[model samples]
Target chain A: MDSTVTTATNESVWGGGNQPLGASYGKLMMWFFLVSDALTFSGFLASYGFSRFKFIETWPIAELVFTHVPFFHGDYPLYYVAFMTFILIMSSVTMVLAVDAGHKMQQTRVIWYLFLTIIGGAIFVGSQAWEWSTFIRGDYGALETKGGRILQFVKADTGERAALADFAKNIPSEREDLQRDKGLWFQSEGYLTSRSVDEVVEGFVANPNILIRTETINDDNHKTVLTREESLKRIKDAAHVVEGANLIHNEYGSRLFADFFFFITGFHGFHVFSGVMINIIIFFNVILGTYERRGHYEMVEKIGLYWHFVDLVWVFVFTFFYLV
Target chain B: MAHAHKLEIFRGLLKFKTNVQKIWAVLVFLTIVTTIEVALGIIKPQALTHSHFLGMKVLNWIFITLTLVKAYYIAWDFMHLRDEKNSLRRAIVWTPIFLVLYLIFILLFEADYIYNVFKFGFVKWNF
Candidate 1:
């Protein structure tokens, strides 16, 4: 019975013969898993789109938000992300090469390609961690209004963004942070911002060259800058000084934007991390001649499929988050 | 046993001599597309931004189209879907493409409607 089931007879494929689709059980299952995984990612991206559309009028521009590089910094937008994109693509290339070499039963070539692919994935994941850190530690602080709108500052003369440290006054005041040990057991809060709202308002009033840029986008597709009088009036509505992005507050613009950024990118980064781990396991297997003993390297091919799926997801993430 | 790969891309308009060469060719194509995307994003030509096609900026449409092109090559070549049986390929590809399209369409349409309600309705925004 087992031999009959395993044998490929000349029967119609619709008769449920062996390997009807010409794919092994493991490979076919992997394809199905990938298809489902693709839908999950699409769901996240579509929800991101929904939130972006809901906040269309005040959606933060991706170029302005992601302008920082690691070492050299003077407003280089999209360069670091582009490099990351290249690295992921290069890793995908190496993964496919490993798979190809596996087909020819070339263990040494497979090992080298897998090693390169692992290095590339590590670099990409490290870059993502760095990007998240910078985003969490925002460059310029902003004011959050009672209505939860962000108000960034700009130099009236140059129209460049003004950091809170640049103009905030050194007003002497006693501000204490809530601590679990020092405060009520049930009431603990995060650390205080660098400067208080009163200090920021005073600094703005003292500096005549400062202007307030609202989150609202005007007809010219830029943030609406208020006049000096309007700036002063708007400053009074500020309830807190927001330094960076979190689930609740975002210095970039809408809180939902930061939420989606963290959720989607964090999810993708986790996928890369796992892919690297799986690749490392496969790398050791190749080094130990495990596939040679098995008389096949289909394991490498399976993992290659997974690694390529990761890169495929990144292509969409980069497009939706950065370019579009 | 090693299986043969479909070496040509772009509907057989271009062909490669070997599987390795085909993979490299696809990589070059992906890189070029990415470069174009980054350039267009940075440059953002005024004409493209000003013009609207199908309710989106022309630049965005270009980006999406190029993205799909890249995705096609990545799937067909890198994932070896091109070497799979037609039934297997369709099972893997068509299922997600159809479902994702439906999902995106319904969600985006509903989102646009909600945006209008927030924009013009009596309910205040960010409320």
Candidate 2:
């Protein structure tokens, strides 16, 4: 078909045209991919919204969840996430600069800016990994009720949140650590919690200062703090003492929150990782005079489009997941 | 090599003499918007937090609006959508908006119904 005589010209709309929309084939394809990728992300976030809205009263608060800073960890809510957003935006700025340099055929400027963008992406991926670990290894542990609700403890007098380590009883019961020899068929239990349900319930009863805070949000927009008698009553229904978040359980609140948090952010993190790798390849290609010989720097511009798309998705993620 | 569009933003609301200058201008605007979002999130003034609008917190409405503003500028300025042809711009932008909005609306409404079932029905509120 390509070698045969053609009736339609390159400018024609149905002639397998390259510029019907005044965009190159590659650029248009990249945009199309971005549109679909965006839809995938929207699906994930929408489901997250569904679960969050359904459990609106008990959904984990972002401010309380993402409170740790890199070096300093003292109730610095949204500080690190704000920093991550800033870095991503700044990387977008650098990517734009690289594209502008490519347009001008300034190879050196394009290389430098691309290098900066790669660095920014690297930093973001690193921070996201650290965040994942922090989330998995939760800070203050809680008791998982039989009905799947979390019961965190707070100071009755000060109203400050308390950690499991602070009040869990150091019980020296005959709880044997199962090994291969002790097991009937060599099947072993998973990682055991530091504090058993009995250990936690016993400690809660002994400590008069510790009060139970249910995951439910009251009219005041804060978690419901139960009375002293209610705390004792609630602990009796404790099924297990959950230490950290996994696919099934979370010490913080709803398991759906952790599920979405892991899936959405993990997908975004993978995108950033692949983007950096692509940028690196393109950076070397620029240095090796590949684009210079090809007579256009469109490759750099293509990668730039991808980089900005990553940044754009983060804007929504930051808003819906963290802020809203 | 010489022909890149003139450096301006916001439909010429802001003008920059150099491409570098334009990049910094966009960065500054993005920074300002992000700062406002972070400030509002942290301070969370009582009035915005306590009130309800559209069945959600007014503060959340504010956050979502500002985030859209940030996304707009990133796509428009940083990604150079502003400098592209009209047809190209529409092709890239229009397809996602309709689908995403429709999807989100349907899912969220379903979530509300499920929430009621959890609340008043046989399913206990917690467990």
Candidate 3:
């Protein structure tokens, strides 16, 4: 039995020690979790790359499509997203400092650094929300045709985008007088009078020249755009242009890109949020002298691993979502 | 009096108090590198734009190189990988390096294949 036990011990890796790497159980678990998380994020990014390849052409240019605002209607490129990335990276720096302070048993410093990290994370989340809202609202709205294709207008002169509202004119309401009472015989019932599909189709067909195609319009300059004379004539006949995004095409951008962007970034934002919460908990513990009592700041080091993992994820996300 | 002298000697030898200063210097260097990356990305020199190395655009190569540098500092210094033993360090670093490289190779090849299909295949996505 003794010989067998000796052989087993010799065969074991890491000098037969159970506690290899000298890492605490918690830290080891964190490493494992991070590895798995890394794989999960890589899967999402790979899928995105594959889809991008599958739709290489006709896919929207990310920079051009993403530029828009609610109040300001003009061209603003990659600056906003770049700033958000900087914010997240800076937050990671603060987190590292906080962990360092914890190791030194400097409770006050830890508190301050952790607070800064939390603030940075909150700002990032807010910026992501703004980005999502802008994406959902769209900038230069595209026309969704019956064939499920998006047709966007570009300025003929400057190649800037033209909004849907630029080409669409409002049609005056044609409300009929409501009849409260009818002398027709039987029990009175609610009146039902509406334009049926066939009627609407007939109305549209009656004015073939008025049905303006979106492709006929072009952006002319930074400020004002122009619609082709033929398109203008068609619009004069048709009365109104179609107004929002639809199943075939999104006004904001490509539906698939938007969907993937939201899913990936939203997931990452959730991770940042949870990381902040964990940091806060660790912050309180540091202040309460928990690590000081334990004679080491290994807990801080462990949390540092988690914080750095979040930073690493953001780096990849920034590259794929913005730069690439 | 003897114990006090020994304590002073211990502090002198360990230099434990100055780790923070070293860390701050490293952090400053990292900030500079990141700023450089952003600047390069924005400027995108004409020479670099047209040049290709290793089947990738020069700009992409630059970005990857700088990113690796940043990763090095973040892992080796910030995460204290440098302080770890050889086996422990290898376990942490080599695993990720090997796995990520393998993944990139497979994915890039797959992407190129798909691009070829789109270029030559029967299906016409463009209207």
Best by DockQ: 1
- lDDT by residue (A118-224, candidate 1, tens digit) is 99999999999999999999999999999999999999999999999999998998757676898678887866899999899899999999999998888766889
Better of 1 and 3 by lDDT: 1
Candidate 3's displacement at residue A74, Å, is 4.3
Q: Score the docking of each candidate (DockQ).
A: 0.59, 0.58, 0.16
Question: Model 2 chain A, poorest ten-residue lDDT window?
Answer: A1-10
Query: For candidate 3, lDDT tens digit of each residue in A164-225?
Result: 44433444455555444645455454432232223333433343232222422122211222
Off-target runs (Cα >4 Å) in candidate 3 are A1-18, A68-74, A145-149, A171-249, B1-17
Q: Model 2, which residues run further than 4 Å from truth? A: A1-18, A181-186, B1-6
lDDT of 2 by residue, A30-144 (tens): 8889889989998998889999989988898888888898888588988899999999998988888888888778899989999999999999999999899999999999999
Per-prediction TM-score to the true structure, in the order listed: 0.95, 0.94, 0.73
Candidate numbers, best lDDT first, in rank order: 1, 2, 3
Pick the lDDT winner. Answer: 1
Taken over the whole model, the C-alpha lDDT of each candidate is: 0.90, 0.87, 0.62
